[model samples]
Target: WTEHADKKGRVFYWNPASRHSSWQHPLTPSHKALVAAYRRIMQEEDRLAAIQSELEAFQQQVEEEVKGWRQSHAPDGTPYFYKIGTQNTRWDNPRDELMAHMDLRMKMLQELSQMPSLLEEVAPPADVTGLDRTQDSAGLSEAAALTDGPGSPVAP
Candidate 1:
């Protein structure tokens, strides 16, 4: 297998059998690296999924808070309030109660963006090679068994 650099400066594995020089093609070294990377990515993906659930819960709470605020305030209030300017700005309307909600939404989005990196803290350190060790099907299953139920037979 030969490695080739693309116009965009991305390194890809090339094989004579397949016409494609990209990483997606069937190249042994690239495939191994991709598989390892994929395993590591799974943890991050699970974290993102949990973050989605958390975001949804927060959204529900925000909705409830907004609902309560609306009921207690002006009867003719807009749900979304915006500033009308590129740089200089003011509340779209003086009576808009949603400015706080918008602020909360922005905060939530920012936190959500950081969630991935935060979740990765538990991941193996960058200097630690073989974070997700390369294992064949049997080896993976064998290793996975160690974390299984109490009844699982431990290999002697």
Candidate 2:
């Protein structure tokens, strides 16, 4: 087999015995099917890589957010604890509000933990070339908008 390049710089492989160019050579059905499958595989692999990268970025963001929340709420690094006892052991002012906030934060972390499995369950679309695969600050902007708005849990 010999490889030849046309005037347009397109290269193709063909048998030396053939008089016609590689392009003029007839491709068998199986050869066409193999080429189509190869293209599909390449496209799918690219899509999967993009999705994996996005998922990793999202995972890192969740971890950082949870870490920041924990640091801000508990600078001492002590885990929140609740104790049930008689009136003598119970303080007059219970930290129910702080506990509620901590509960919400815990729930958020729990939801974040499920992200990896969710990512695994996601499949690449048939046509990934047209999809926006960029990882940008749009998600952060949306999150900030939600948190910095009026009646938000956190103060500006």
Question: Which pairs of residues clash in candidate 1, taking residues 3 or more apart in a chain or in different chains?
Answer: none
Model 1 — which ten-residue stretch has the worst lDDT? 86-95
TM-scores, one per candidate: 0.27, 0.20
Pairs clashing within candidate 2: none
Give the worst 10-residue stretch by lDDT in candidate 2. 85-94
Give lDDT for model 1.
Answer: 0.46
lDDT of 2 by residue, 61-140 (tens): 44543433321123566443323332222121223323433344444434544556433555656642332233457643
RMSD of each: 20.4, 32.6
Candidate 2 lDDT score at position 155 = 42
Q: Rate the local accuracy (lDDT) of all candidates.
A: 0.46, 0.41
| Model 1: per-residue Cα lDDT at residue 43 | 59
